[model samples]
Every structure is written in structure tokens, then in C-alpha cells.
Target: MSIINQMLKDIDKRDKPQFGANRPKSVYLGRPLRTRRLRLILWGGVFALLAFLALSWLHERLSAPASDARPSAEQLQIQRVPVLISEPTQDAASQRADAETADASTRAEGEPEETRPRTTRGEQATVVVTDLEPTQTRAEQPVEPVEVAVSEQVQVPAQTSMPVVTPADTTVTASDDPGEMSIQRSGNGVGSADRLFQRGMDALSAGHNRNAVQRFREALLVNPDHIGSIEQLAAIQFSRGFAGEALQLLRDALERNPGASDLLLLKARIYERIDEPRAALDLLRGRQFRLPQDADLLILQGAAATELEEYTLAIASYRQLVSWRSDQGNWWLALGFSLERSGDPLNMQEAAEAYRRALQDRSLSESARNFALDRREALGY
Candidate 1:
């Protein structure tokens, strides 16, 4: 009985937990009987650290572009249009001031007056006009009349003592080449001038005179440096028989760029159209004028001289015109007329020779050819 009790006690001792032992007593051979929980904890920590690093890398990759300073290639191509704003003139200023002051009166009377844009006679708002069927988008926004920037440039004094001399009644014309008047679009598309200018040209081509004028004016408003818009606007005004307005715009352009020979020639032609031949001649003879061997200038000179009865000057100008455009029948016709009008016996013989040259041009219109023949008969050629 004692031996049985001793064997049970030994089994109980072997099953007890070793609380303070250096190694667990539950070991089988050289290894633990159960898996180590410490190993699992270490593996979990390693996996967690790897996941954190991967997530941080992804976050950085996504946010890099937003932190960059420079604009992207796509952003640089976006068109930036200008919003047009008008300054009230002196009379408009007085009216607005009066209206603002009358707020007290309105408060006392229990009535209010609506504010409105005021335009002087013949001046229209600077805006892009569409077809006869008005666009709802455009109609919703009120068009405000703006003072042209180019005109203001003309009024500015060049020096403190010497006031800028701008011809108040100036006018200009254009060259035959359509390309000479076209403004090229910019690479970066920074300004709205190109779009507005193109719209104006399209409107002009479509026979929408009002729309063309407004678009051109708006284009100039967007970029005051757009000389093409100013010239195009002036051309529309001239075609509509508003010669004075055309002249005013041209003078403003010339004042802004005094060195532009195209503007000078245009101004001379406008003077000729207005029947002021003397003015045309004087403009070409200005001190600031470059000595241009341009065909248009020579033709203008000859025509103006002929009109003024300056036969000697007319002869010289016509001779130069013939030198450049020998095929121009009108030039030969003018030369003959100038020589005949001189009334010199030597010029009379020269007039007969000039008439013979005019009759040789195949491109000359029938009316012009008949005129040449009549002139030749009159000159006893």
C-alpha cells in the first residue's frame, strides 16, 4: 500500500508547472513539446513593419505632382481671355455721382432709379457679336462701352514742353495683300487676342458687318498691342461710309507706332479718298517720314500732284511709278495725262509716247483702254 501511494505522488510532481525554472520542464528530447509563441510574435512584427513601409512609399508617389511649382505642358496651353471693363467718361461720371448722391432722396421719397451704361453719340460697346439670331449666353451679360486704348496713347505728350502732334482727322488704308493685315497666333496661348481676331475675320467673311466691327474692337480691347484689330475696325468703318471714324482710328494707330510706313501710306490714301489731296501730299512730306520706294506711295504722290496742278511733281512721281510697275496701264495713262497737262512743247511729244504704252496692256479694262485711245486722239498722237 505505501509503494502504490509513492508512485502516485511522483506522477503528480512531474505534471506541475516549473514557474522559476531557467528552461521549461515540458521539453521532449532537445526541443519544446509546444510551438514557441515568441517566434509567432516576431514574425507578425516583421510583416507589420514591411506593410507600413509599402504604404508610405505609395502615399509619396501619389502626392509628388501637387507639390511641384512649375505648370505642366497641358496647363500652358490653356487660353486666358481678358475681361473687358469700361471707364465712365466725364459726363457719365457726373451722372453716376448725381445718382449716388440721390440715394438719400430715394430713401426719403421711397423710389429708386436704376443705374445704366451711358454711351456717347455713335460709340458702341466693345463686344463680340454673333449672327442675327442673338446668343442667349451673350445677351445675359451686359455689354459696356470702353474707351479705346490706342486713342488715349495718341493724346499722351511725347515731352513735357512739346505736346504730341496727332492729326485729329487722320485716316488710313491697307495693302492689297491680306497676309499683311493678319496677326499670327502666339505659341503659349497666353492671350485672348488670337481667338477674338479670328472670330472678327470669320464674321467679316460671313458678311456680318456689325459682328465683325464689334469682334475687332473687342480683340483690340483684349490686347492693345493687336494692331491688326485696329486696322480691321477702321476698314469696317470706312466701308460703312464712316470715313471720319476710320480716319480717327488710323491716326491713333500712327501715333502709337510712328515708324510704321504701312500706316503712313494708309493715311495718305484716306486723305485722297476724302478729296484732300494737299493733305495727302503734306503727310508724305513729313520730316519723320522714311524715304520709301513703295509703289503705293509713288501712286499717291502722282495722283495728289495731278489734282493740285503741280505738273512737274506729277511727272516725276508718275515716272517713278512706271519704273516699278511698267505693266500697270493706269500708271501709263496717268503719266500721259501729266505730260499733256504740263503744256510744254517738249512734254506734248512725250505725252504721245506715254499714251502708246498704255494701249499695249492686255490686262487694262475696256473702259480704261477706251479712255487711253481718246487721250491719244486728243494729244494728236
Candidate 2:
């Protein structure tokens, strides 16, 4: 058997014809074949992966909108309103520079030209704002429409320090809040009261509030009953954290013009500022002062009634508001809120109905519509 195996090995070595002595056949030949096959497989897989990635990136790029798409002019205007700045002319700038240089030279020389005017009045007492809320809404139940009082031509105050009357093409429409009044005047050929009021308004717009207050006062002195002066001055006082002063001023104006709805409403707003909603409501109380037809009065009544938990009155007032402006989704929402807070079982279905109606209004803002929808769903509508 050993002789036969030796003969078989000798025959296999002769037939295979070995290339190198002492070299392993498997290490040289088998390893190289296996490595070549593995390399081909790896390269194929890499190419396939790259192709897949390229296809995915191309698909994404094709699906998106073009990058160069632009908004319309109107859309751009709405999205980004431009702020205008006052530009002084070259002459004005030169004059200002010259004045500043003269001032600097005077200070450098230490020569007493003139003492700066100092205010004689001492520091005014600062009034702390009370946490009390005012009850009044803007219910100004006027006995009759208060006509604008016209005077025969009042003299314009001759103050050189007054701001030059620039021809501004701007027209500011006053806020239409219930307690507020609008003041409109032409930039050119306006009445003395109007011109002074305009100057005060300009000063206010410029944020020179002290100057604005002075101009308003001057306007009032020129025409004591100028509604514009009264409204603007009170507004400024209120803004300057002097709610009490504004209220008192409005009260004085009301005394002079008892039937002025604007004054009554303004006073009510001040009452609300001091956390006295009941007082605000009282201002509009009684059949003589019941201004059911007045939209502004109804709005104030609704707000004050709601604050006092007078749900029935609130509902009635809100309903009147809705009738006057059916397109106003907020009024409907207000009515719905009043109904829901009434705590009466009958009011539940009515509240749901109101919410549903509000939801149907296409003009309603997204947030308001969502709020109404949520309320309707919660009420099992």
C-alpha cells in the first residue's frame, strides 16, 4: 500500500509540472483568483451605490420649485413696508453745521453768551399706578350729535421755536377704538386750531412728547373747546402714564360739553384704566343714556357687561354689534363667549350655534377660526 501511494504522488507531480520548488500552490494561485473575484464584486457594489445616490439627488432637485421665483410688487409691499426718514437739504445741513460749530467755539472760549433757560417748576410728584381696573367700556351715550364748534379765526401763536410747518402729504386716520376720536386737517391753509394741532401731532410723531404737550396746550388756549386739542392732549397724558390726569381733563371737557359722546367714551376708557369697570358701566346706565343704536356704545357696553359677569346684557350688546356688522367674526365670537359664560343650560346650544356661525365666516383669521372650531367641537356641535 505504501509503494502504491508513493507511485500515485510521483505521477501527480509529473502531470502538474510545478513552476517553483518549495512554493505552496494554494498561496500563489488560489489566493490571487479569490482576490480578483472579491475586487470585481466590491467595485460593482460601489458603482451601484453611486448610481442610486445620484438618482435620489436628481429626484429631489426635480421635485422642488425653481429657486428664482419672486413675489409680486404688491406682495412685496405688504410683506416689507418701507420706513421713511426725514432728509435735510444741503442748505439746512450747512446751517445746522454752522450753528453747531458756533456753539462749540462759544463753549471752548468759556465766554458767557447767555444762560440756558431753566424751568422754575420743581419736580412733579410721580403718581403710582394702582392695580385697580376701570369698569367702563367706550359707551358714550350722547343726547345728540355734538357738532364741531367753529370760531371766527383764532390767532396762531407766534413762537419762533415752533417746528416749521412742512408740507406732509401724509394723512393719519385716528384709531377707531370706541373711546377714541379722529382728527383730520389739511397740511396747507388749515385753521389756526388745526395748524397748532398738526404741529402738536408732528411733535408727537417725532417722539418729542414734551414739545407735543406744549403745542397741544397752546392750541387749547387759542381755541379752548377744540376737540382735537382735548383728545390729543388727553391721549398724550394717558400714554405718558398719567391716566388720572387724562381722566380729569376728559371730565372737565365733559362738563363743558355734557352731551359729547367722545368725552364720555374717553372718560370710560380712563375708568377702565383704573380697574373700575363698574364705574365705566355706570357712566352708560339709565334709559336716557341707553345708546342701543350707537355701535361704539354697544361695543363698550358689551365689554363692561362681560367684565361684570352680566352675561345677558353682554349677549344683548354683542348681538346688536353683530347685527350692525354681520361680517365681523370677532363680534360673533364675543357673543358666543358671552353665551358660554352665562351658565344657563339653554345658552350651551346657543353658544355652539354661535361658534359654528363664526367658523363659517371665511373672513375670520386662522387663529380665530380655529378657536371657534375648537369651541364648537367641545360643545358637541
Clashes of each: 4, 13
Give the 10-residue window scoring lowest on summed lDDT in candidate 1: 149-158
CA lDDT for candidate 1: 0.65
- Model 2 — which ten-residue stretch has the worst lDDT? 77-86
Superposition error at 81 for model 2 (Å): 59
Question: Roughly what TM-score does model 2 have, to 2 decimal places?
Answer: 0.46
Per-candidate local distance difference test:
0.65, 0.67
TM-score of each: 0.44, 0.46
Tens-digit per-residue lDDT, 157-196, candidate 1 = 1122322332222222233422112223344332567778
Best by the lDDT measure: 2
Q: Candidate 1, TM-score vs. the true structure?
A: 0.44
Quote the positional error of residue 126 for candidate 2 in Å.
60
Model 2: lDDT equals 0.67
Q: Which runs of model 1 end up more than 4 angstroms from their true locations?
A: 1-191, 286-293, 365-381
